[model samples]
Target: MPYIPLEDHLPGITGLLEYSKDTAAPIRELTQTLLRGPSTLTEGERELIATIVSHRNQCTFCVTAHTAAADILLGEEETSTKVKQDISTAPVSDKMKALLTIASLAQESGKSVTPESVQKAKDAGATDIEIHDTVLIAALFCLYNRYVDGLSTVTPTDPAFYKGLGERLKNNGYNRLPEGYEHLKK
Candidate 1:
């Protein structure tokens, strides 16, 4: 059970967001902009940043949800898995590898992000915006991972639940909860 009362039907961050729509609004907007907004980074790449951070934090819900989203956007499940296991060997471009390195450092500690990492990303063709977004996405997911785990929110074990969530995230872009889930807001 969650540490606080949360809708059982709405697992993980969804329940938490519904528990507080006022707070959820800014979070949803930020998430939408970072993950789905126009940028040089592909949606898959952004989701990969989220996945790596959540995985490092050991937040199962966020990791699985974002892994699904990354898989869907990238059209391959292996890439996310590969990245979580080892970014160096993952089949992404050099720029992505370097950016993910920066993200990982940010996950550890904002201060851990060395100038060398930034330089590596730039050398690999990462624009300043890409580097900026990678670190921000990493920092954001760190907050999210802690929030969900801290609250002990419901974390569904079903793969089907995550699949549906991935589809919704891909199609809806996090502006609001899906239509059927409105009951959570009450």
Candidate 2:
């Protein structure tokens, strides 16, 4: 059960977003711009940043959703799983690993991100835009993780559900809710 009353069938952030379109509208746009919009980082890379931060925060809902999205974008879920398990040894490029390190520190505390982290990302071939976006994505997920977990939202236990959600998010993008989002509306 959610900390606040929400539609019984709607889970996680879906219900929370639907509960107030006023807030959801802007949040939706922000996500669309951050995760779906054009960027030097591939969609998979951006989603990976989000997934890492969510994992650091111990927010199961955000982690599950973003992990699926990252996997869908990357064409393989295992790679993302490996990165989450150990970014240093993951099959991703050195630049990605460097960016992930920055994301991890951002998840801990924005101030924890140091000049060295930025320089390491640059050394790994990450551009200024990539570094900036990685930090933003990491900080954004921290807010999202808190939003989902703080409300005690209902998290789906089934992997298939998250997989399906990943497809929906990838195909439809976050500019608007998925087809079934209407069910949560008053």
User: Which numbered prediction scores highest in lDDT against the true structure?
Assistant: 1
State the lDDT of candidate 2 residue by residue for 100-146, as single tens digits: 99999999998999999889999999998889889988988888999
Summing lDDT over every window of 10 consecutive residues in candidate 1, give the lowest-scoring window.
177-186
Candidate 1 has a TM-score of: 0.96
Best by TM-score: 1
Off by over 4 Å in 2: 178-180, 183-186
**Candidate 1 C-alpha lDDT tens digits along 1-186:** 899998877889988888999999999999999999999999999999999999999999999999999999999998999999999999899999999999999999999999999999999999999999999999999999999999998888999989989988899888884565865343
For model 2, where is the 10-residue window of minimal lDDT? 177-186
